[model samples]
Target chain A: MSQGDGIYPDDLKYTKEHEWLAVHGSIGTVGITHYAQSELGDIVYVEVPAAGAPVVGGEEFGTVESVKAVSEIFAPVSGEILEVNPALAAHPETINRDPYGDGWLLKIRLAEPKEIDALMSAAEYRKYIEEEAN
Target chain B: MPPAAGPLKTTPLVRLFRDMGARLVDFAGWELPVQFSSVIEEHLAVRGAAGLFDVSHMGEIEIRGRAALELVQKVTCNDASRLGPGQAQYTVLTTESGTYVDDILVYRRGENEFLLVVNASNTDKDFAWIASWARGDVEVVNASARWAQLALQGPKAVTILQGLLGGPLDSLRPFRFLETEVNGTRSIVSRTGYTGEDGFEIYLPPQAAADLYQALLRAGGPHGLRPCGLGARDTLRLEARMLLYGNDVDETTTVLEAGLDGIVRPAKGPFIGSDSLKREKERGPARRLMGFEMIDPGVPRHGYPIRVGGEASGAVTSGTVGPSLKKSIGLAYFPARAALPGTRFAVNIRGRDALAIIVPTPFYRRPH
Candidate 1:
C-alpha cells in the first residue's frame, strides 16, 4: 500500500488491457481495474453498451474521455450488459479518487466461462503493468 | 533500446522539465514538454499572476505588397482597411462557404507589409489555402521560420513587461503593437494574447528569443512568470472563451455558427464566403455554439452527446473542470432556443445522463 495505490485482490481476474472481472459461475462483474482508472485520471464520460447490447470478445465496448484525451474501453470477453454503474454519472472522479469501491464501470453476464482462467491473476497483472511501463 | 524512432525535439527550457521527470507529450508533431509542474498549478499561475509561453511553434505568414491590406481584407474576417500601420486585429480565414480555415492575428506593419500569425498544424494548409486564393500581386510569405513568438500573460504581466521593456507598456491598446528594443534586440511587441489577461506578445528572431526569455525570467522572477506548457495554454484559452480551431470551429463549422459574427465583414466587398456568410447572417443558424456548466459529476468533453429533449441535438466541442471556477464547464453546439444562458440540458456521458446548463460564453473574464 505504501508503493502508491495497490492492486485490488488476488482473486480478481484481469485482462492485459486493464479490465478486471469477478466471476460468480457464468455471471460476471466487469469493471476497469483500479490501475486503469488511476492512469486515466478523472472519468468525465463513459460509453458502455446498453443493458441488452451484445458485446464481442476483444471488441470496443465503450469510450471514456478525460480532460486531456479520449480512450476506448475494450471488452475482454463476449458478454451482455447486466447493469451499469449509475453513481459514476455524477461522481466520475471516484475512479481516480477511489477506483475499487465507486469506480467499477459495469456488470456483465459472460458468454464464455473459460475466458476467466485465461486472464492474469492480481500478482501477475501487477507484474504485467510494471513490465509494460518499463 | 527498441530501434529509437528519432530523438525528440525540445524547446529552450526542455531540460528543466526533463530533470524534474516530467511526461513529454507530442503536440502537433512537436515533442513538447507538457507539464513541468502540475497542470492545475500552472493553470492557476496564468489566472492569478503570470505565465510564460513558448509559442514559437505558431506560424507567421506575411502578406506583403501595396495590395497587402486589400488582400488581408479579402482573405480574413477582420476589417484590415480601418487598421493603420502598427495595428493588429483578431481575424479568421474562411472558406467560400464561410467555414473557418484558421483563426489568426493580422498585424499591419507598414503600408505594404502585414503579418498573419496562425496555428502551427495549419501552417502548411493555411499557406496553401491562401496561395490558392491569392489573386493580387501581393506575395504571401511564410515568415514563421524566421521568428519565434512568446506570450507573457496574467494580471502581473503589465508590471513585468513594463520593467522588461524599460518603461510603461500599458499605453498600447488591445490589438496594437510597439516597435521596441529588448536588450537592444529589435522586437515586435503586441498587447494581445490568447489568455484573457492583459499581456504582451513579443516576436523576434531565434537568436534573440533565448535572451529575452532569460531576461524576462530574471526580471519577473519574483512577479511569478512561470514557464507554462501547452496544457495550461489550452485551459486558459478555453476559460477565456477563445475558440480552438480544430475543436470548436472546423471546416464544417461556419464563422456565424461559431458565434464569430462580429469579425466577419459580409459587406466588405467581393471576398470569399461573402454570399454564404450574408445568407447565414440573415437567416440565422439552426444550431449555435453555447457555453454550459456540467450539473453532474462528469466533465463534458468533446464529442459527448448533447441532449435537448431526451435526444441528441449536438455535441460538446470542449469541456473541463475549470480549476479557477471549481466546476465543470464546456462549449457545445445545440438548438438556438436551448442556447439561452441558464437553460438546462443533458450530456450523455457513458450511457448515463449528466445534467448541464447553458451559461454565457467565457466561464472566466479578466478585468479590463
Candidate 2:
C-alpha cells in the first residue's frame, strides 16, 4: 500500500515470479514488479548476468539484495541477454522508485515470440496477485 | 505483504502502523513492521532529528524480595552491587562455558527490587534459566506481558519528550531511569538506547501504548520525528557496532572473545561462567571479533565466509551498507593474530570474493 503499488502497465506481460516483460517485436525489457521491490524493502545491490549470456525460462539469472534479505530474479522466457542495467550498480533503489521504467533489469532477445501469449496480461496479473495475497 | 494472520505474535502498535502502510515482516516469531516509507529514510531521520520505535516485543523480568540482589549477582556476569537505586547496567546472562545466554539490561529499582530486560526471542528460555537458579526468598516474574516499550532516539529526542514531562529531566543521566508520567500515563522513562544517540525508552501499560504513540508522533512531528521500524533499528545498531544477540553473540560466543572484557568483573567473586572466563583470560581468546569495511563493490551479509591474508577465517556476524556513513561495514570473527586494524580480508559474496579491510569500529558516531 505504498507508492507505485497499484501500477501495472497494460503493454507489459507478467510472470508468476513477479517479473514484467515489455515485448517490442523480437526485443523485450525485463524488470521486477513494484510489489516485489516493496516486499523486498530497501534494495541495496543487484547482480545480473552479462550481455550475450543465454538464459532459460523459469531459471534464476540474477539476484536482488535488500538490507535484510536476498531474492532471485528469474527469466520469464528463454532468451539471450542483450544488455544489463548499468545504473543498478550505483543506484539500486530505482527499483523502489520507478520500477516500470528506469528500474528495468535487462534487455533480452526473445527465442520464441509466441511465448508472450502464455503470460498474464496486466489485468490478469492484478487478479493473480490478489489471489496470491490470500 | 498483507495483514499478518495466523500464529505470529504482534506488538500493541501493529494496527496503527499497518494502517500507515508500514511493511510488516516476520522477525523471530513476531509479525512486526520492517519499514514505514523506507529503511534509509527512517535511518537518516533518526540521525538528523529523531525516530520513535515500538520495542514492546523486548522481554522484561522483575525480581523482588530480600534476596533479589543476591540472585541477580549469581546469574549475571556484571557487578550489580555497584548499582544504586534507579540505575541500569548492560550485562550478559553467562553460560557455564563463559558464553552468552543473552545480553541484557539490569535496572536496580530498589534495594530488594530489580528489572531485567532481555531479548524478545530469548524470553522464555531466560525466564526458565533464571528460575532454575532461584534458591532464596526472591520472586522472579516475567513482566513482559504487562509492559509496552517505546524508544525515542536521536539528537532531538530530549527536545520532543521534554514537552510531555511534568518536570525537567535534568536529573536523568545516561543509563538512568525514573518512575514518572508521560502525556498523562504513568511510565518508566529511561535515558538509554541501543543506537548511539541521546534517547529515552518509555515503558508503560499495554493499552496505553497506542495513545502515547500517537501523542509522541504529534508532539514530535514539527521536531522531525519519523515512525521507524526494525529495519532502521538493525542498521542504526550496526553503525554503532552494538552486538545483536543472535547474530554477533550467542551461546557459542564468549564475552571475552566478543571484546567485552571490560564488563567482566572477576573481583565480584564466583558467578556462572566466572571460572572458565578466568582461564580464558589468562590464555587469551583464540579468536576475536573485528569490524571491517568493504573495499570492493559487494555488500557483506550474515553467515558469509571470509578469508584473512589468504586463509579461511570465520563468517560475518552482522553487516549492512551504513546509511549514515554510506559504506559497506560488517563485523566478523577472525584469528587473534589477524584481528588488528588495517588487516585485509576477502569476504565471499555468493561465488565471488570481495575485498575488505579491518577498521576501527563505531563506523558512525554522532557529532557533539
Candidate 3:
C-alpha cells in the first residue's frame, strides 16, 4: 500500500505508471491517481476499453484529453474489464474534481494474483509521486 | 534573415508566469507561460473584463522606403493599397504552391514605412523570404529586439486607455493606429487584438515596456484586469473561432483549405502563389477545414485521424475541449461533405474511437 504522496489508498497496490488497484474477491478496481488528474487538468474526453475487453499488463487501454493535450492510460494488470466508468462520458472534468472517488475508471477480473505482489505499496507509491513531481 | 541560429530566449514575462504558478510549456522553442490562472478565468477576463498579455515574443520587422507597399502587397495575400497611413491589415504570405509561409498583421506607418508583426518561430524565415523577394528599394530591418508588445483586451479597454492617454483617442479605430505620447515617450496604439474582445495592442520601446505594463496592471487591476498568459489568449481566440497560424494553417495548408478564399481576391495582383491559388480555387480545395465536437468522451487533437463511414478522410490540425462551451472542439481538414455542420464522424485518437459531430466553427459567441 502507498501513501507517502498523492491520494494513494492503503488498501490498494499500485503500478509505477500511477495506476492504483484495489482487490476484492476475484476482481480488482483501477483508477489513476489524483496527481495524474491534476497534471492532466480537466479531462474533456476519455477513450475507455469496452466491457469484457482483455487488457494486457503494460499495454495502453485508454486515452484522456484535457484542454490542449492528450495522455494515454495504461492497464496496470492483465485482466478482463468488467465495468468501465460510464459517468466519465458527460463529466470528464470529474477526474480533476474527484479523481479517486467518482472518477474511478474501471473494474477488472484479476488474471494473476502474483502480479499484485509486484505492485507498489501505499508508502512506496507516495514517494514515487513526489519524485515525479520534481 | 537565416534560420534561427541561436538558442531560444525567455522574456521577463516567463518569470512573472512562474511566479503566478502557471504551467509552463514549450511553444515555438520558447518556454512560455501557458496559463497563470485557470484557463476559464483568464479567458473570461478577456471576454468580459480586461486581460493583459505578454506578446513580446512576436517578431517585428520594419520596412522603410517608397517600395514598402509594393513589396508588401506582392508578398502577402491581401490588398495593401487600401491600407492608408496609420492603418493595418491581416494577411498571409504563401509559397508558390499556395501554402502558407506565415500569417501577419502589417501596420503601415506611412507611405514609405511599414511594420510587419510575425509569428515568433517563423520570424527569421519570413525575413529571409521577404529579403530574397525584395522588389522594394527599401531597408528591411528586423526590429524584434528593440520593441515589445502588450495587449490590453476587453470591453473596458478603451476606457482604461482613455484615462492613460489623458485625451480622447479619436484617430484610432479598428485597424487604425495612432502615434501618441505615452509616459513622455512616443508609443503606437492600435485598435486590434487576437481575442474577439475590443482592445488595444500597445507598441513601445523595450525598456519602457515593463513600466507601462506595471502602470496598466495597477490601473486596471482593480477593474478586473488580470495578467493573462498565452494560455488565455489561445482559449479566447479559440472561442472566437479564430484560426491559429501553425495550428489551423501551416506551410502545407492553403487559403482555400482554411476557408480564407474570400480574403484571397485572386485578381488583386500577380503575386507568388497566385497561379496555384487561382487554380485551386477553381478546382475546389482537396479538403476543407471544419469545426467538430466529440459526441463521446474522447478529445480529438492535432494529427488525430478523422474517419467518415469508417474510412480515413483527414487528420486534425488543432483540437481542444473548450472551457466555456464545455465541449471538445477541434479544427480539421476533411471532405467537403464532412465539413457541413451536423455531419457525424469519428476521430481516432490514439487507437480509440471518439464519436464526433461537425459543429459550426467557434463554440462560443457573445450576445449581441
TM-score of each: 0.78, 0.95, 0.87
Per-residue lDDT tens digits for candidate 1, residues A29-126, read: 77788767656544556666668888776778887765566678878777898888887766666666656667778877898877766788888888
B1-368 in candidate 1: lDDT tens per residue? 12125665445545555664555776766567565555566788988899888888788998988777777878887688878988999988989898988999989899889989998878888998887777767899887778888899988888887876754686788889988886568899998998888888999887778778778877787988787777778888889889998889988998888888888886677677888888888889877898999877666778888889777887889888776776788999887777688888999875778898988878898765
Q: Rate the local accuracy (lDDT) of all candidates.
A: 0.79, 0.91, 0.81
Clashes of each: 2, 0, 9
Docking quality tier of model 1: incorrect
- Model 1 residue B63 lDDT? 90
Question: DockQ score for model 1, please?
Answer: 0.21
Q: How many backbone clashes does candidate 2 have?
A: 0
Give each prediction's root-mean-square deviation over alpha carbons: 5.9, 2.7, 3.5
Could you give the DockQ of candidate 2?
0.73
Q: Please give the lDDT score at residue A104 for candidate 3.
A: 85
Candidate 3, which CAPRI tier?
acceptable
* Regions more than 4 Å wrong, model 3: A1-13, A22-28, A50-57, A78-86, A108-114, B1-7, B159-162, B169-172, B181-185, B308-311, B336-339, B352-355
Give native contacts recovered, as a fraction, per prediction. 0.25, 0.75, 0.44
